[model samples]
Target: MGALAGLAPIFGAIGTGISVLGTIQAGREAKAQADYQAKVQEMQADEAQAASQRDAAATYRQGRLIASQQRAAVAGAGGDLTDPSVIDIMADTDFETDLAARTDIYRGEQQARGLNDAAVNSRISGKNAQKAAFISAAGNLFSGVSNMYSRFGAQAKTTATASGSTRPLYG
Candidate 1:
């Protein structure tokens, strides 16, 4: 019984250590999960940007095709390509085509930027969680040690009193 009682503090310390380790591990896992989510978001952002570029290119190609058709039709009807009205129409078509293509690119860039911002936010959140976990673990460790010391210290004082010790427990 005496030996078992003496081992109690050791067992308590071990338990505290285990608990602290578990807390730290949980924090690390949370950080890792957040990092993974951030990576996914980043990939999605890249995809959005890529899709926007493809859309813009397609818009440009469509605009060129339309312009070619307009030129062919005017030549067939014997209309002068250099006529002010004809030039205005061609210019309008070019302007509209360019605007549409640029709009697609702008929209895509906005989407990608939003996604990247989200990824950055996720990373920050993950880091905060990890830091909080470590802080919590340290608190637990300190509390555990304090509790163990108080318990042992009380027992030691009791034993000293019973042994008729006159010396102070702490100089």
Candidate 2:
């Protein structure tokens, strides 16, 4: 019983150390997970941007083909292909096509930005988790040390009383 009592503080310290290590491990895992998620987000954003640019190019090509066909039709019908009305119509068609393509690209860019923001937020959260883990570990260690000292002090008082001493034996 005396031996066990004497060893109690050592055991408590060991237990506290293990708990702190586990906390630190958990923090590291969270940070790794966040980094992976951030990488995935960046990859997805790149893919989306590429797809948007490709679609925009295709839309511009289609618009050009359609405008050419309209001009050819006007020329065949004996209408003045250089007439202001015809020119305006062709220009409007081109503008509309360009607008649609640009809109698609813009939407994709916005989505990519959102994903990037989320990734950043995740990273920040992971860092916060690590900080919390460290704080908790410190608290646990302090509590464990306090308890160990209290127990030792109580044991010393008991021994001193039994020995009929006016002061603690070790002191």
Best by TM-score: 1
Residues 7-91, model 1: lDDT tens digits: 9899989999999999999999999999999999999999999999999999999999999999999999999999999999999
Residue-wise C-alpha lDDT for candidate 2, range 27-61, written one tens digit per residue = 88888888888889888888888888888888899
How badly does each model clash, as a count of residue pairs? Answer: 0, 0
The 10 consecutive residues of candidate 1 with the worst lDDT sum are 155-164
The C-alpha stretches of model 1 lying farther than 4 A from their native spots are 1-4, 154-156, 159-171
RMSD in Å for model 1:
5.8
Clashing pairs in 2: none
Return the lDDT, model 2, position 74.
95
What is the C-alpha local distance difference test score of candidate 2? 0.86
Error of 2 at 112 (Å): 1.6
Scored against the true structure, residue 81 in model 1 reaches a CA lDDT of 99
